[model samples]
Target: MKALVLAAGTGTRLRPVTHTGAKQLVPIANKPVLFYALEAISAAGIANVGIVVEPNADDIKKAVGDGSRFGVDVTYICQEQPLGLAHAVLVSQDFLGSDDFLMYLGDNYVGGGVTSVVEAFRHDRPSARILLTQVPDPTAFGVAELDDTGRVASLEEKPTRPKSDLAVMGVYLFTSEIHEGIREIKPSARGELEITHAIQWLIEQGRDVTATVNTSYWRDTGNVADILEVNRHVLDTTEGPGAAAGEVDPDSTLIGEVHLEEGARIVRSWVEGPVVIGAGTLITDARIGPYTSIAEDCRVSGSAIRSSILLSGSTVDGVSAIADSLIGRHASITTAAAGGDSHRLVLGDHTRIALAG
Candidate 1:
């Protein structure tokens, strides 16, 4: 079977970060969100992959080039515009040909991966198979209603009054019959051919449309909160604290489950783990708290930070405390301003500040 990973959506929700870079490239635990999806696809043993990209997403092309590093031969398909999920499938028909394939949203993070689901799809050979998970807010997702036999009876895309709390997970497996459904369906009220509608079309035609409720972790990393939550989850479960690879002065204290990558230096600081310090980052006379990921080439000195993500080249100096934040690349944060005796901050690159001045 082949794979189609959709990475072309304009992530307006993650704004100003998405304004400059692809949302799929956002790092969770210092690894890009797209890399996790690609790893999941490779683990499912589908090597012939087609990545659907936006027209001008050259960064994505540069980052994922040919997919050889992931052991998958990838073909890049241009979607031209942010049409819809069904439209993505329609455009990828040539790459997919007649092969049964898995369609995965590139910005999604499915903990425990999709290996079992892929195996089940291969064995069952359903016309369409979707993963469902119970979500608190069904209105934000494409929801499904199940019949007495637990089959997918009906589907709706982001309904105001949802019939069920079972939201469709971003991973889907489909046979070639889905192409017919996609062609037969029209755009929704939102003026896009939603995948949910195409699945509903198949269900109307008496095709085998199946769904499996996911009990494991699954998150769509669209907003900052969700990204931080997923990062914390992954770190807690998969990557606990570890030995420091870079230099650590005797004055520094390393607490639980911290992963210090190569070239990371810690001096006169206290670091609490379940935290990952990327390579070449320096933390001196600072307090690094739990659930924080500091990216490469960053410097944190004379500050206290917790539960935050600092991208590469960011500097945090002389701050009292920074928490529950997302700091973008090349950004700088300092406590002193040119005139104010009070707090002064010069923030850049999608920086979010929750503290009151």
Candidate 2:
């Protein structure tokens, strides 16, 4: 079996960070989100993998080249536009020819991996298998309606009045039978071919389409709030006192579950985790704790950052406190007023701001 990872979407919700980098490349626990999907797929014993990407595919290519690093044979399938999920599958037909495949959204985070899901699908060999999870807002996702027997009866894409709370997760298992379904589907009102429509087509034709409700954590890291939520979820369950690879000064005090990637420097600071400090980042005389991720090459000094995500190349000057925020790449936050603005911010492209004040 092969795996097809859809990563072509231009993450408009993530803004400045996605402006500079792919949302799938965003880091959690100092590891890219794409890496998690790749790792899980690799663990599921699927080797031949195809990644669907947009025009900005160079960065992804550079990051996962040939997939050898992740123990899989990588193939890049170009999608000229972010049309939709079904469109992505239609474009990858050649790469996925004749083989049962798994489609994983590169930005989605599924706890405990998909090895079990793969096993269950392999055992059943249905026309299509989709993962579902109970989400608070089913209208935001492809919602599913189950029958009295608990089998999925129908599925709708972002319905106004959802029939069930079971929202379709990003992962999918499909046989070549889906090719015809994809071809028969029409574009939705959003001007994109919806995957949910194709699945509904299969159902209309009496194909056996199954769904597994995920009790484990699963998140479609689409918006800023969901991204931070996923980070927090991962940190909460990850093993305590994460892998340390970089330098820690003698004066620094590290506490709780923290992940310091290689080349990270912690000096004269108190870091309490559930936190991930990426490579080449420097932390000095600061307090980083309980759900904070400081990305690569960032500098933090004499500041306190909690429950925040500071993207690569950001800087927090002395006496600053950034809490429950998402700081864009190369952004500068300082306590000193600039042009009488109390706090100064030199933000990057596509940046989003929600200040407490």
Which candidate comes out best when scored by lDDT?
1
lDDT of each: 0.89, 0.85
Tens digit per residue, CA lDDT, model 1, 255-337: 88888889999999999978899999999999998999899999999888888888888988877767777788777777653
- Model 2 lDDT at residue 59: 85
State the lDDT of candidate 2 residue by residue for 1-357, as single tens digits: 999999998988877667777889877765788999999999999999999999878888998999999999999999999899999999999999999999999999999799998999999999999999998889889999988876779999988999999999999999999998999999999999999999999999999999888998888888778777888987888874464688888998888888888899999999998888888999998988879888899989878888878878888866456666677777776555333312333245434343332
Query: Against the true structure, candidate 1 has what lDDT?
Result: 0.89
In candidate 1, position 83 carries an lDDT of 79
Task: Please list the residue runs of candidate 2 whose C-alpha ends up more than 4 Å from where it truly belongs after superposition.
Answer: 240-244, 338-357
What is the C-alpha RMSD, rounded to one decimal, of candidate 1? 2.7
What TM-scores do the predictions have? 0.94, 0.92
| Stretches > 4 Å off in candidate 1 | 337-357
